[model samples]
Target chain A: MNHRRKVTVGGVIKYIVLVLVFIFLAGPLIWEISLAFKGPGDNVYAIPQYLIPKTPTVNNFVEAFHRVPMAHYFANTLVVVAINVLGNIIGCSMAGYAFGCLKFRGRGFAHGLFALAMLMPTEGLLVSTFLLVKSMGLTNTLFGVALPGMVGPLNVLLMTNAFAAVPKELIEAGKVDGANKWQRFVHICLPQVKGTITVVGILAFVASYNDFLWPLVALSDDSKYTLTLGLNRLQGTFYTDPRLVAAGACISLIPIIVFFAIFQRYLFEGLQAGGIKG
Target chain B: MARSVTQPQGRGDARNAPSARRHHRAIDDDGPSSWLFTIPAFFILLLFVFYPFLNTIRLSFTNSRMLIPGHWVGMENYVKLFQSDQFWTALLNSSLYVVCVVPFMLILPLILASLVAKGPKIIGFFRTTYYFPVVLSAVVIGLIWTNLLDSRGLINSIFQSLHWITTPIPFLTDRWLTLFSAMLVTIWEGLGYYMIIYLSALANIDPSLYEAAEIDGAGPIRQFFAITVPGVRSTMTLILFLSSASAFRVFSEVYVLTRGSGGVGGEDITMTMLIQREGTGLSARTGYASAISVVLLIIVGAITVIQQLIVRRGDD
Candidate 1:
């Protein structure tokens, strides 16, 4: 009976600690959400700090959209994200297929090139990349922002691993039936690794969506600003009003949250794969 | 199905075929088309990654600006960089960031992972919630924390009401406090990411070892040290390297937190910020920035080499 009591106490303590951690991790987000819904009459600086707004309103969202071109920026971000996702998926899968299944001369050397590119410190290369983009006359364009990261080397390696895991017997069967390499790749290998393809697609989407630094550097034109840049502008313009800034943050953040919630399983899988290898 | 018939045939072929013949077959099977498959990715890597890297090194030796390609200046840029006080401050700030942030990142995430690793169904919910911050961009995280850490923000108000302090803490305004505040945000944003990595590593540890320890009446803490730490030692080292490297290169958090000023007198600037500041815009000192970029590269490379040495030693 005493042992049972001790176990119960331990369980209770574990739960208490878990709850505190949850509050620590997720509490700020909740507060931000609360602040977004707050009406003008609500004292944002209330001493006791009420998380629940006394008066709720959508005015802040309206004001945020009004003050900044939020909708235009959102559309701009989507276009960039589309280019990034398509580019990474098509480019990475093709490269990955070659590295994983093909046995040609200099294959190891070619693969090492990708590994070298993967390990290159992007932060250190920002200036030169910008210069390269400018020399190509792509600066201030969304394409410039999307160009450098379109084919991530890590994604190529991930897709390579995925394609390699396709059953060898299946490939042999395709060969025996007189299907060429392309046909076997498309009809046999590609379908089998749909899970990994989805993982790749989701990773590319999140990365392009969340990318801030490159876009900040590449885009000098206000009309071409992605959502992150737009929000930064909003923060600068509306520093006095906490509510509008909170609402702007929510606007940019909600879509990602929804997307993450839906595809978190695959995201986690991709993250683990990338994390381990990287 | 035809697959069943071909499976044995494939096995027989594999058995009958010598390894040399298989290699020749594979080469013939791929042909030049395999090279075609790799072209697009390689093009991007060469054009964007490798060329720029080589160009940065060359540009570091020249006095290039944003538009005009200026003449070579020998080692003048490096000489000036060594003399610059701003350079030292930025370097010190970045190093301080790595020092302050890595330990907490190493310890906290492992504890979080272990807590969630084995528990009821609800623990899965906790794991997901913890990862919410990871998905949010650094901009959103910066905005969220800036609001919370503001003088009239939620935290200060709570502290004041509770009589914890007489003055609202200058989390965003004061120089050192601002850097530390940014570090806090870094830790908050990174907790979930590193936690996931640790969780994956923990899953690979042998369950039988834990059961054996439990039978021997070893408590959780003792078992964690004796079994869990050693099991995840390599992972811990990995996290240490990852967290420190990222901390050194931190940009967005400090940038957003300071609203692009890099704190008063730009005291809180990092290496990336310094590079961006010098290398961008019209009249930009691209040559000087390239020199700093080379410095950044050398330091990160040093970290990686040292980490490899440590990992090799640990293996021995």
Candidate 2:
């Protein structure tokens, strides 16, 4: 009877803690979402500070879209994301296939190089990269933002591991039927590793879409600004509408929310497959 | 089905067997094509990633600038960095951030992951709820928080309403509170990601161990220490190294919040912020910034190596 009472009490505590945790985690984002509907003149803080705006409207959204060329930012962002996704899929998968299936000299060395590259954070190399990109005459171009991310060491390593999981018998059988190396890869390897490629593509897309520092450094003009860069310009040093700022911020979250909503299964599966140990 | 479309390509290779065999024999049969295939990635990384890395190290020795020419200056930059007070202050500030933020990033996520792993009933809700922040860019989060923390903003209103404080607090522009504000933002943005990682790792752990522990009358807390902790040690290590490295190199939050002002009397100045100041701030001391970058690089490298060693020894 005492143990039963203890269990019930414990259950209650768990539920309370989980709810509080969710609130704390989601509070700021939810607050920003709420402010999106509030106008500039409305008191951002009314008595009791209405968590839900009473007079919600889309004017703020329209103002943001009109003031900034939202479509241009969207186009630039989409172009970069598409290129990054394609590059990451092809480059990482091809390299992953090499490391997993085909044996050659310096395989271990190449793998180690990729791992070391993964450890070198982008911040550490920002200065030289800036100069390098400048020298290439690619500064202030979308290519500047998209080029460096063309092939990621992390994706290479991830794909290598994922490719290794495909049964060697499958590849050997393809080769036994006189299929060439390219044929074996196309026929036997690519389909088996589709899940890894999809996951890597999604991750690359999200990261490229949200990246700020590199793009800010690379792209100089206001016209080429991605959504995050454009969002930075919305609030001045002082004397700006916080509600409009909040509303503008909310717009950036929509694409990510939509993407995750669509591909959540692939994201989780990829993360689990990639992060969990054999 | 899409599956059938791919099968024709597989079947085509089988149909053109003789020609495919000829093509295979014409090329070197030792699979040197594997190495050939890896060349694009190799060159791309070498030129962009590795080449820049080497150049940065070289520039650390020189008097390089953004807009002006520079020449080799030997170890002068290193000497200056060691002697400068700002260098040490920034270093101290970064270390403080890492020390304070690392534990919360690890522990909070671990606890959250455990809660979600309890059952599938609430898993969907928890996943989306936690992951929602991970979707927002750091710039967006930075902008939103800056508004909330302003003197006349929502936080002050709430505090006043609750009678917690009689007057508004300068949360962002202040010295200590500014650092705390940045820490809070970093934790919020990062918590979901680490939680997802822990959840995945927890999911991968065999459930029979938990069942065996229950049979032996082990409580949840005890089982957590004995089973769950050990199971997730590698993951915890990875997260620790990544978070600490991120903390040491923090610039975006500091930049957006304080406008690269650091703190009152420069108390909140981080090494990365100082680098930015040297490069583009009114000073535009390019050579000096490069020197600062060298020092920052050394500090980050040393910390990463130390963490890696600790993790390795613990694993052994």
Best by DockQ: 1
Lowest summed lDDT across 10 adjacent residues in model 2 chain B is found at: B3-12
Off by over 4 Å in 1: A1-6, A275-278, B1-29, B309-316
To one decimal place, how large is model 2's interface RMSD in Å?
A: 8.1
Candidate 2 chain A worst ten-residue window by lDDT:
A269-278
Name the runs in model 2 displaced over 4 angstroms: A1-7, A269-278, B1-29, B263-267, B280-286, B311-316
- What is the RMSD, in Å, between candidate 1 and the native fold over all Cα? 5.2
In model 1, what lDDT does residue A144 have? 88
What is the per-residue lDDT of model 1 for residues B1-316, given as tens digits with 9 covering 90 to 100?
1111111111112112223224544354467668888988999999989998998999999999998898899999999999999999999999999999999999998888888998668999999999778878889889888899999999999999999998999999999999999999999999988888888789989999999999999988898889888888888887888788788889999999998889998998999999999999988999999999999988887787687678668656
Pairs of residues clashing in candidate 1: none
DockQ of every model listed?
Answer: 0.49, 0.34
Query: What does candidate 1's lDDT look like per residue over A23-79, in tens digits?
Result: 999999899999999998899988988987899999999999999999999999998
